[model samples]
Target chain A: MKFKAFLTDNGVSLLEKRFLPALDKMGRICHLYLTKDHAFFLHNLLNGDGVQSIAQFRKESLFEDYRISSQNDDRIAFTIDLGLLHRALRSSVSVCGHVTTATNRLQVKLVKKLTHNSQQPMPFLTFESKGYKSAVIQDVPISKPLSRVDVVELQSAIDMAQDLPQTLVQGPDLHQLQSFVDRLKHVGDLLHITITQYGDLHLQLLNTLTTLGVEFRKLPVVGVQAHVPSGDQNMTAQSRTKYAVEKGEALSVQVSLKHFAKSLQCHLTKPDCAFYGITPLASCLTVIFQFFIPGTRQTDKSISLHCRLPVLDPGSA
Target chain B: MSSSEADPDIPDLVCQLDNVQGMVDALSSVRWKRHQDSVLELSEHGIVVIVEESGCLQAKVYLKKELFVSYEYRAEGRPRFGVSLGVFVDCLNTFSVSGRSSSIEICYPGPDMQLLLKSVDTPDACIYAEIRTKVPDTISWDYNFEPAGSTPLSFTVKSAALKEAIDDLEWPGSSIQIVLQPDPPCVQFRGEGHGDLQIDFMYYANTDLLIAFQCDRLVSYRYKYKFLRATTSNMPGSVIKDNRGSKLTIGRGGMLKVQHLVSVARPSTQHPHIDSAAYQQPSRIAYIEFFVKPEVDEEPVNDA
Candidate 1:
């Protein structure tokens, strides 16, 4: 069985600039699972933070072809170093590249040869899975294919993230929001974020010594129907509420001033950035930064970054 | 896109340059470990960063206000605070990606406040860091070397040659020994531990490589490479290639001064609106200096 993605420099930048920031918000490694129609990236962390799954729909126009084996239940999953893979993705100088899994190794081949350099070999980078390697280099980490149970956990995490209630924030410039939170942190380090029933996202810096709060009021809301948001991730949601978020229904999540600031990094590169906050009552809090690949022929090549951070409230702990 | 167009809120301190690598390189001149908790003081002039080791050796790097394309300090008083050096660097590095044009603005409301960095260029991304101001003065080792006055031996040399000479030396030594005299080998650099290895650097009358060489009386000084090594490791190789000449001045009482300009100025002819009178493109020099105190000479004092 073979799965291929015609990786373009844009796609590689998507992996380098966008993908790494999302993982930087979460864990060190991620599991890449490829099915017949789409590529699903799953991360189920052990630190009780929650799970994250980013699904990229196969755009035939952007890709040479995204093909999976026709055999029954042939979905393949392999673990990779999120940071290292990002660097490998960026190492290619070609407009076109190919990512293929064969002989138990995932090879990223930069297929576009530069006309100026005829002496250099066709550049390709490979990642060896523990399942494929007979001997291991001491201390160096070796990635392995995901086990059946690991797949189950990641799928459950994805379903849970989708099943969870998410609030999309608008109106406030992220720079302002970030600065406000950062400033309040000096007085109090623990930041408590709450979404009021009136569609306002309330950010509060709370500690035993001081309490400061800011309310981002009346952010427009999209309809309740659930699917991956429009591919133009940065575009502000224009669809006025045919449905209003339940009033008085507030879900709050507490995080350190540092963690909240670190998670906001993914939005730096995208000018028109959109932020979505996912807080499921009390377990953990997740923030999704969405952006789109600017140019594509037939379809929208969009990416949604989901980062889960532990909600370590002193009272809760 | 320019920073003003990016909608980064009314920045308390907004400064931009063609690139940020020079400031990062300048900061490298200062030692890191001992100065970790020192509050980074921001004034109308620029950031005042003082890095010191034990009460004897110290380095101060000033990211001058002029170097910034635009600098606005809204804070009333001088803001003194310490931020995590590693975390702060990580935020600025986001703009270091290739082909991605970037304009950076650093904003903070007051001292002990959160330091926010917004890059209007690439992806409009921003980084937030929690700066601790309460412990700004925790690193209180202030050594007054008084490097401003006249020195015994002062000379300028190409940064590349000095770096190569240091690199070429068999570094298996405890400390570095430097000797400047009026003899044939005008300047001698030695590395001594298991064995003594010495190299000579010659002076030229007029050349870009060796800008100037001023010799006073004969003098020899020895310093622990460990402290100097920690400081030099931060010099990013990219800036050295810009051919910014370096000058080494050994002052009275083993006080050593190393000064170099690192910024590569875009020609003044290119900027049509640049106030030539107010902003002299040639005067737009980004200089970094390291004042290293020579280690106490352990050799017998009466010996020749």
Candidate 2:
């Protein structure tokens, strides 16, 4: 039977309960790859010299080289034929793998395909007995949503803002402030929905949402700026005996926000300028602009950094 | 699964939980274990005293502690005392379960006649004692010896026993022996009168890893009576019979023999000792001592 990699928790459970047990009962376990967790439990079943059963053989040899870490978005697949499954199951050793099959309605076409290219190509034998019956398996249920919420929210917000006034009688600054607040609330709502609905589904949820369209902007804070040290142009003979020394300083980014209660920097924080060693008056460095969704808040103070101009040691100079 | 349809090979009951009850039944299945060890000592006078070594003829003899020997001439002035000597130890082989039983052997080949050897096996072999000898002044001989033993004895649970209960098997313990003799035999009032002497013993290890020793202590007393002091102005009726010869053997305990086959429950119980985090890290070795006696060279000497 053809096999597929289990991607979801339900899919994994189905593979373990239905597929693995069926294969075990049918005794077709050789040449199967299982996840590390599953292989750990099944390793004791396989038979070989030093290997007690197929489970052990797969666990030691196959899993070591073939088992992929589930942390990555990679898929693993396994395939098995019916005749082999029948022979393996009938053997005394315990067999386990994906998709077990029983041989009842004999077909030469299917039988020949089972033995084709196999390491040991042996003839098929009838494996029917009293109380030996084929195991029945069912597919697991999964649901997929037709549309995402962010797309609807964006469209609705755009349509609702059309009737708002374009004039500045109340004050243009106040009008812009109100518009910005409205957009911020709309974005935050979208973020909450995206995080809740798809967060636990898979690793690709966050990346996928970003690709489809979602954004978070960090709030501005004080940040560091870099500058050369200011000193007296003249130096004593002893001070001049060696090479010149270069120093750096940090400065804060100052910006005027009309609605802000006090003077606020466009930068992430006042601490940012000092972190980079730039002094308050150092204008050599410029504040950088960053874009994010309105819902994103200032998690930390931003820092600006620059290296000190190289100063050569006296002996080297 | 119905009992009738289940594979006949599968036991009627496969109760993983019932194994504990079976273990409780085996609590009384006591298996005995035995242990033994070999001990040897070297005296400053070149005498080797071996106690309950692996086998027979494991003994220690004292020759010269610092190679300083004074001469005492006989009144008749015959063969002088202070003869250079060497003691030879034949073998110190390990005891085998299948081989013929063997014990320690000590020998003294000297000019003097009459030798006496002694041995003792103390319970637990834990006592630390010493043996002293009385001999005339200026007697000397060099010797060497090794301890041999009966086949090494250790306990292992049979496969059948393991299938039932592993705790029924016995475990071994450590073995130790002490030399019951003075440090250097050359000093006055020691075994200074005797020469060409040896001792040996057998070592055994039981289930508890303790070694039991069967040691034989032997002394070779040799002397000659002369008429007068020939070198120092003729004197009559003076005898120069002095203690001059000795030999020694060094025996060490063997490594503990470990069982390789571990039953399911046995591994769960014993593996913790080997698997614990305390032993998982690397550490330094504090100190190590090796005691092995060299064989005697018996090349004939010239009598000028």
Candidate 3:
């Protein structure tokens, strides 16, 4: 193995015709008088990221006898310390230099064989220097793996989303409960089977009279009326009339049960009936009316109902 | 050098040199070529220059001066203005010593009539006889007009004298160029003729709506002609004039025929009745007239 570098026609003209001769004649004097890093700087600029440091090149064992010249056309020739350069060429870090060495060494040898076998000079440079042959190779480092910080940040985002509300319930219990409510009407009477909701009942329940054939009504709501004065205008001059009705007639009894009491409670989530109008009954009921069934303690289910009976007859009163 | 001791021949030499210098100055003054906004070129001869005054006020003032030439002939046709150019009598002075004397009284040549009347100091009401061409025995002159009040604008002509002057006038070989100034937006033209000489009194004017008149239509060559701009007082912004202070060149005689008119009508109410009689006379027109005379048989010069 050896350190090798090949120059193109353009590179050869710049170095062999212009720079190298100046270098050979002046050497250390040239380095001192001119910019200290001429050759290294030019090589680095031309090759970009591949050239070695100037200190490394100067320390080579065969630094003194290097050959540099313009051969006929625009070709350039340069010799390097083969033994020391071979060590650098064998190293993984010196791949660029290794590639130059390998390609030029083979090219030079092929040219030699062709020239020796033929009756003419081959169309390639025949180097006479001792240290100018090595292999060339691509030189780039491998990419590194992702860092821990990135992985940690990704996992932390996932953990931060865990407390969000459930988007989907995953069980058979909800289906079973829905089926129970749908089939509740078929349950036996002894169980006092009643279907309701977690709010007020809007309809009256049927009551059976075991002793009498006639059924009476019960008021679920009370009504009270008071005279209210006009807010504006001359009410004092306006005529006012008071009278006993021409004849008292019987009035129909009806109930106005609150249909949204529990719904209001649930929506407000308050212990008091602040969201509902709780009214007292004007007539006493002969039968009890179940307003609503609170949700089951363990299952959270609710129901509502209403019942009715006759108030006392006037004669009885 | 003493003044009296100087060579007598030196003064003679200086005098001869002065004469040569004078000859050069004279040659230069005899400008055979000229360029102007309005030019009537005659080969190897002076041109008849018509300077279209730009503003309405200026044109009105210029028109009052004999800068305006009016010719009235009661043919079986409409009234119009026409102008033609003959050899300016002033030009004859150059050849007077060469044994050629005019046998006719070239009294008021076109340009002289225009210049004298325009530059004259006569009051608007006072009419002076600014003689044009008194062709010794060819044509007579006349001055006629109806005054605003009682008096009449009268013109008298001697028929016999006019006939004699007409005969003595020698046109030999000459060309005439008539510039048609149409009223701002009037393009009315009526042409009638039996053969080579057709007469048309076309209404034309400068862009100024005020300066307009009926003139003889002699446009044969198609040319792009420019007229003074009509002042657009009603246009809200600064007045926009297509040919504001610029000469319009009718492309190579192509635009010689005038058909379209661009005009700015005066506001009727403000000056109502003030100029009604003058402005609204149906066949009314205002125009400046001039003529050009080029040597006959000489080809017209193509404008460079």
Best by TM-score: 1
Which stretches of candidate 2 lie above 4 Å from their native place?
A: A6-40, A45-317, B1-294, B300-304
- Tell me the tens digit of each residue's lDDT in model 2 across A91-180: 311221232224221111111123446665332322222123433222121111112243243223223322211110111122222232
Task: Encode model 1's per-residue lDDT on B1-304: one tens digit a residue.
Answer: 1122233455456566555555555654453552343346678888776655566566666677877777877555665656555444533443333333335666653233456554444332232233333445555645555543354477777777666665655464677877776554267788888877897776543356566777655677776776555435555564576555678877766677776665524333435456334234544556666667777755621112
In DockQ terms, which candidate is top? 1
Using all chains and alpha carbons, the TM-scores for the candidates as numbered come to: 0.56, 0.14, 0.12
Which wins on TM-score, candidate 2 or candidate 3?
A: 2
Model 3 chain B: weakest 10-residue lDDT segment is B11-20
- B1-304: candidate 3 lDDT, tens digit per residue: 1121233222110100101111112222212222112222111111122222221011110111111122221122211111211122122221121111111111122222221111112121111112222212111111121222232111111222212222222121122232333233232212222212222222232234213333222222211111211111111111122221211112222222111111122223435554344334322221222111111224543222
Off by over 4 Å in 1: A1-50, A54-161, A169-275, A279-317, B1-21, B31-35, B39-47, B69-130, B134-152, B204-209, B264-282, B298-304
TM-score of chain A of each: 0.64, 0.14, 0.14
| TM-score for chain B of all predictions | 0.77, 0.14, 0.18
Q: How many collisions per candidate?
A: 8, 125, 48
